[model samples]
Target: MGLRNYLSDVASGVKSLLTGMKVTGRLFLRHHKEKITQQYPDNKDTMVYPERFRGEVVMPHDDNNEHACTGCTACELACPNGTIKIITKFDVTPEGKRKKAIDTFIYHLQLCTMCNLCIEACPTDAIKMAQTFEHSVFDRSQLIKKLNQEGSKIREGVE
Candidate 1:
């Protein structure tokens, strides 16, 4: 009886192995139609990302080089990783009234986890996540980017 049981166990193992091999053989034969390998760099131009894909943060500046950031620091506060820094400047109106404005908006790409919390916290809709994912750089200083365009000022209605 023991001998019969051992023989049955061996037969069962062999049957399972053969079944797995049969599936693998079928896949090997159908590899041409169902390509398992991607061409990588060659397919870069054709690669498409979803609408909701989060890559990096970018501030959209208008043709006038103006943006909606009011130096409110809402983005700085909401960032979980302290990736955003806002340098403020005082804008003096014609009436000699001083108002707070954004001097520079610094974004540390190396520290950012792309959580989108900063974009959500912004009341002025200033910042948004860009679809550009290729952010690799040789130097760490290159990763720290200014989201605002050069010589860009806050929009007129942003106050």
Candidate 2:
């Protein structure tokens, strides 16, 4: 009885495999006019990605090199892995009070899962997902990016 049951299971598995292959063969033989495949390299210049595509996280700096990130570490805490590192420094205000500021915003793209959790946790809308998807690089170090621009300061009115 055990041998018979094993044979029956193997037959059912083969049947399922054949059914999946049938569908794939039918699609493979479909007319060329169908939009089943995308010519990626050919249409590289004209490719249009959807607006909701979460490619990478980025901090948009304004014309005056000001960002909205307050070194709150909200994004770093929200990441499932240690993909984001926010190095902070204390800046003395005019009144001699210390305020937290971001010295560097390190983003490890190789470790990122593109979960969008960090973007959602940002209270000041300091970071958001960018649309640039081509992230291939020769060296692994190239995947590590510093989000904040040089000499960038916190934007006025954004804490």
Candidate 3:
């Protein structure tokens, strides 16, 4: 019975080795027929990223400079690395009621892990991951960006 078990183990091991070798041989033959590799810089114009690629975070505003951010701090609180900073201000409405508004939405690209947690945590759908991968910069200060545009305000009827 011991000898039989040993032979079975050796047979299974040989079967796994053959399966691995077959896959390797298939890939080795495919390498000569297919040109899957792409050259950078030269092919930058035609380069395409995958669907789920995560890049820098950006806040999009409409033509009227209105955004959806309500200054709720949900995105700021959800960020694991503290990449998002929300500076809120109290704006007095025409009805004499003070409302919370976003003053400045600062994003530190250097500290960001691109985990998409902040985007997912936003209740108002305020922020999204922009499909921009070019982040090379000579100065470190350039990496820190303000997500909100100047003179931008929250859209009307948004909670």
Candidate 4:
């Protein structure tokens, strides 16, 4: 509007530009001295992920591919979004005992937010987050992973 006001506005714009440029100039000068990125794949073995990194879910297994899940359903109950649907079935043991084993441990990754509540609520430490982050797939159905192998027997004395 006025000449004085117009000149002040231009001065403010120039000041802002110089301020931004100062930061960029500093970063450019220090770029060569600092290592900002890692050489991935090569350094993957030595690489350390942050403690709070949200990766994919994986059921922990022992040497025999047996897990400690007792079909407690605590994780399923803790998941607010119903991402984890665990179907359980009772089996009559040779000693005439009705044991609860997980029939199906279906995890819908598309519906999960990696909240970690399910992991915490698990009484037997059945589930945990795996560091494998590459879960991209063309089909939506591929995102749902069955944790338990087909025809796998639940470990005895897991309860």
Candidate 5:
């Protein structure tokens, strides 16, 4: 009985091993036609970013270097992680009326979770999610970026 049981165990192990090898052989043959792995960085130029992919928030500036942010602090208020900071300065118009304008728009990329809350909260369509996710830096301060450029002013007719 013991010899019969040992022979049955050996037969079962051989069957299992043969089944696994068959699957592997099939995969090895099929690999020529179907690629299962992607070579990243090498395929970066051919990579296509899908729509609705939220990577990072960026403020778009036109040729005149004007942005749509009115410094309403709506983005700052919507950020649950406190990743956005809006510094405002009162601009004196020719009529001497003080108008609020954005001085600096600080975005802490380290703390941002890319939740798209700030983009959705922007009323002026100033901020939008950019399709750029590869943002790695050695220094933490490098992660903190100012979205607005130097000498950039609010776009005309954007309240």
Candidate 6:
């Protein structure tokens, strides 16, 4: 309103600008001294992901290409969004026992939120989050990966 008041407001504005500038100046001066961001893809060799980083669900296979899934349906039941589907069948053993085995383990990545609830629900640790992040596909159907291969047997000693 008055000349003095206007001059005081101008001084306050200048003081705030200087305070902000000081912080930026400090950051700019230290920018070259320390690493702020990683040049991804270029620095893939040096990139370190966290141990618990949930990337994608993968059924681990042993050296014999056998998985640990026992068709328990715990993971399917635990999934809130119905991302995982376990199609099981009764296998007649040599002793004529009706053993349950998974025919197909369909994982719908589009519906999965990566909450790790399925992993937690698994009693045998059959399914887990793999460290692979390169899951981009051209077709939406490609995201629905079958965990178990046809005629694949469950791994021995996997309980």
lDDT of each: 0.93, 0.94, 0.92, 0.86, 0.94, 0.88
Alpha-carbon error at 83 in model 6, in Å? 1.0
Q: Candidate 6 — worst ten consecutive residues by lDDT sum? A: 150-159
Better of 1 and 4 by TM-score: 1
Ranked by TM-score, top first: 1, 5, 6, 2, 3, 4
Write the number of the candidate with greater TM-score, choosing between 2 and 6: 6
Per-residue alpha-carbon lDDT of model 4 for 1-159, expressed as tens digits? Answer: 999999999999999999999999999999989888988878978988876677877787776778877778899999989999989999889999998888889999999889999999988788888777767899999999998876677666767
The TM-score values for the models, in the order shown, are: 0.90, 0.78, 0.77, 0.76, 0.89, 0.86
Model 5 C-alpha lDDT versus the unseen true structure: 0.94
Q: What lDDT is reached at residue 69 by model 2?
A: 98
Model 4 scores worst on lDDT over the 10 consecutive residues at 149-158
Select the stronger candidate by TM-score from 4 and 6: 6
Decide which is better by lDDT, 1 or 5: 5
Steric clash pairs (candidate 5) = none
Report model 2's TM-score to 2 decimal places: 0.78
TM-score attained by model 4: 0.76
Candidate 3 lDDT, 1-159, residue by residue in tens: 699999999999999999999998999989978877777789988888775688899998999999999999999899999999989999889899999998999999999989999989998888898888889899999999998899999999989
Q: Candidate 4 overall Cα lDDT vs. reference?
A: 0.86
Candidate 6 wrong stretches, greater than 4 Å: 1-6, 157-159
Clashing pairs in 6: none
